[model samples]
Target chain A: MSALLEVRDLTVRLRVGGSDREVITGTTLEIAEGEAMGLVGESGSGKSMTAKAIARLLPAGAGVEGSVHFAGTDVLALSGADLRRHRAKVAVVFQDPRAHINPVRRIEDFMTESLRTLEDVPRAQARTRAADALEEVGIDDPARRLRQFPHELSGGMLQRVMIATALLSRPLLLLADECTTALDVTTQAEVMAILDDLRRDRGLSMLFITHDLELAGAVCDRTSVMYAGQVVETSAADRLHADPLHPYSAALVQARPDVTSTAERLVAIPGRPVSAFEAPSGCRFAPRCPHALDSCRSTEQVLTGLDAGRVRCERAATLRGRLLDPTESPTESEETADA
Target chain B: MLRFLLRRGAMLVATLLVASFAVYGALDLAPGSPIAALTGGRTPSPEVLAELNARYHLDDPFLVRYWNWLTAAVTGDLGQSIPLRENVSTLIGQRIGVTASLVALTSLIIVVGGVGLGLLGALRKGPVDTGVVLVSTVSAAMPSFAAAVVLQFLFGVRLGWLPVLGTGTGFADSLKHLVLPALALAATSVALVTRVTRTAVREELDKEHVQTAVSRGLPWSSVVRRHVLRNAAIPITTVVGLTVASLIALSAVVETAFGLNGLGAYLVQAALNKDFAVVQGISLVLVVAFVVTNLLVDLAYALLDPRVALGSRAS
Candidate 1:
């Protein structure tokens, strides 16, 4: 499949207070036509920044480097009407629906505003379209729902409303930025199911950002694990879950508690996560990697092709099968044998 | 909504009653008596004193006297002004129009200039924002009386533009006459509203819904108008309402400074002459204005914010 969106070496520096902080550093990823790509990371890992950069929604005074090409157009270079047109093609559904919807405005206004303002659709036609969109999201009584304000709906209903609103413009790509993270578990599953069904039926490409690895694996075709603002690994979603190549990716998979078999404790990656600007020199994950060698600390890791996937670790070849099992500690004999 | 309004109306009546009692009691507790002011502090003959006491019910207990004043006030008879020798209600009626007109003009200036400048400052940061902040801070710091002196000197005395004293007879003339005093009265309030709106709009701009609106590919202007300003309206309305209400009280200083024959100026003159009936009558009117203004503000809050209406319904 051809790539619908290509973001290469995109580095973003935000001017915070007086100093400039690099939020995303040399991040590269792509979404193929009709593909769902999951971006997995901890908080402050720049997943949301990447999505914002693609949509041209970065805060003022932010400095961006590298290219974001959407359907042969340079997204970063777009301005005025062209920029707005680009945004219309890329819809975003944020985490907290309550926070992202105007509390005072009715659902119809929130949903139909883009159609009415951007496309100049008539109010009556827009309202009809909004009701249809609400129905598509499994909301009953669409007519009544459209007239209700955000505060009148529950969080899950509001999220569905937001999803329905995102789909109104027939966007080519959907940016779901932790869209289900704010919902209850059951509601999360329902919203996820609705999102999956919509994406499949509409052939819409998506960049789904989430912290939950299993959730990403369930809905995404491919997954990219981000660490300190860089893509640490990109591979088939199930394969990433089964055998994660990057040390950080492997650590994340192992951090999940298994329901099939009981473990004494869930494995957690050592040390706190660092932002791109605060990351140390050389390998950003070297300080926390359990399999790090002396050379790992000195060599800066770049995303290099290994097998059918990409990984940033220098030791991916030797440590492939050994990283998954939590019981087996890295032994000196294995290291000597590899050497 | 109807129930909420009815409850508020009842509360308003209760508040007015308490306020009237306080005003009457405080005035009564003052060192001098209405009898002294009526008599010009001269020793009266025994029969004359008896007749004066009998006529004004000066020999009645405090509660009985308060009840008498309250009953008369409720019926629109605010008793006779001892010093002015005029009906208190008639005096208030003649001056009320001037004060209302000044207040209306001042409110217009405040809403337009304040919201406009505030939106400008918030949307265009850097130098314009800094300038707005600086100017508003200075103006807010300056009291209305001080603003009155400066404005009167500059526009009235120095510039020889706009009238400085006496409310004019007709609409155009009255507006022209009241301009300086209104500016003086509205200066601090306008500054206050400007700062409040600026802060509120800036805060609303940072909210997630505004970001969502911008991201939806709606025009930037539409995003600001429909999302940011609409969301900011509640707080802006609240500040504007409070400033407008307080203008009734603060107008006294401006009226005195400009020599306008408004209710505020009449109030000052009455208080100075120890005209108890006039003072009480004006105080009651001021209290009623305050209560009714607050009621309107609450209703405005319901109109501006659906959440408030919903919450009130739930309660």
Candidate 2:
């Protein structure tokens, strides 16, 4: 399948006072049409910045570099009127709905104006479409909701409203950056279910950015683990879950809470991710990786192609060879492999 | 709402009582009595002094004198001005219309010009924001009298575009004379109002809802006008309410400097000549103005935001 969106050597630099420093270094990735890719990282890992860069939404003080090819057009190269036209095909949902909603505006104005931006529909027709969008997201009585202020709605409802607004544009790519992190767990699950249903029904391509690996695993078809300012690993979701090759990815999977297992103790990653300002020289995760060698400390390991995946580690090939087969249970591996 | 009004009314009565007492005490403690001042620091004959004392209720105890003055004040029968011998009520009546007009015009200028400039400075950002901020700071730093003098020199004396002093002309000409004084009074309030407005808008700009507007492909103009300004205006209303009373204080200085026939000028003249009844009458009017202004501000606060009313009710 051809890639729907290809981000190649994307770099973002931000100016402080007069000096420029890179917020995101050269990074590359591809998303096939109807694909869902999860970008997993802690805050300040440039995951959100990358998603924003793709949407061309960074503020005036920041500079972006790279080729973001959406369909056949270089999104980063689009300027002025062309950029405004391109906005109809792409949409983003922010992390907080309350912060994004206009306090004085009724919900109808917010939703209908957004629809008007991409189409020339009459006000009534646009409002009807907004109501339909809200209905699709499970908001009851959209008519009553359309008259209320942002403060009148609950956090979950507001987020759902934001999602509805995004869906109204019929965007080719949806950039959702930690969209459900502010929500309660039950609400988050409900939102995720709605998003999953929408994607399946519309075949919408998405780049989902979040710090929660479980959340990413639940929704994304493929998961890319990010460290500092780089994508360190990418693997198909089921394959990655069954046998993660990179040490960082393996640690993340192991850290998942096993609700089924009656184990008395839970495992966690030992240390924090390296600071972005002083990102490690070689493999970015080498300092935190248990399998690090002297060569791991010296070599700048790039994401080289491996078995059905890519990993940025000097020992990923050898580690893949030693990985337990999918047929083998973890209980058997626990007897043979050392921590 | 009724409870809010009741509470505000009680506070108003207490504020008026305290203001009355202070006025009575200050008038009574003056070096020479109104009687002696009227007699040019010369002692009158026993019979004349006795008649003057009884007419002014000077022989009564301090509290009785206070009670008499308070009663007459509430009844709109404030004896008479010692120097002019005109009824204090009539003198106050003559000056109030002019002062009220000036205050109303100045208020309109502040709301329209000040709020507009503040919104402009906030939306423009960078140098435009900095320039407005700097100008407001300078105005806030300079006293209202200095502003009045400077404006008088520029617009009145130097340009010969407007009259330098006096405001007893017809309404139109009074406005022409009132311009310099009004600008002087409004400068400080406008500076304060603009500063508060800018701070409020800047804060609203950082909120998540504004970010949502940006993400929706909305124009910056629509976002600032609709989304940002309304959210910013809630706190700005409180700042405006506080400025109302200070506006009168500013009016007093400007009116005196420009020789306007307003209550503020009457106040200065009364204090300078120690005309106790006029001083007491003018003080009572000012106190009532302050209380009424505060009541109106509370009402405005409730009207602007239902949530404030609801929250107050809950507590």
Q: What are the lDDT figures for the candidates, one per model? A: 0.91, 0.81
Error of 2 at A91 (Å): 3.3
Superposed on the true interface residues, model 1 gives a C-alpha RMSD in angstroms of 0.6
For model 2, state the Cα shift of residue B227 in Å.
Answer: 2.5
In terms of DockQ, the best-performing candidate is 1
Model 2 C-alpha lDDT per residue in residues A286-319, reported as the tens digit of each score: 7777667767788888778887778887777756
lDDT measured at residue A243 in model 1 versus the true structure, 0 to 100 = 87
Q: lDDT of model 2 at residue B235?
A: 77
Question: Against the true structure, whose lDDT is highest?
Answer: 1
TM-score of chain B of each: 0.96, 0.92
Which stretches of candidate 1 lie above 4 Å from their native place? A325-329, B33-65, B309-315
In model 1, which residue pairs have backbone atoms overlapping below 3 Å? none
DockQ versus reference, model 1: 0.75
lDDT, model 1, position B265:
89
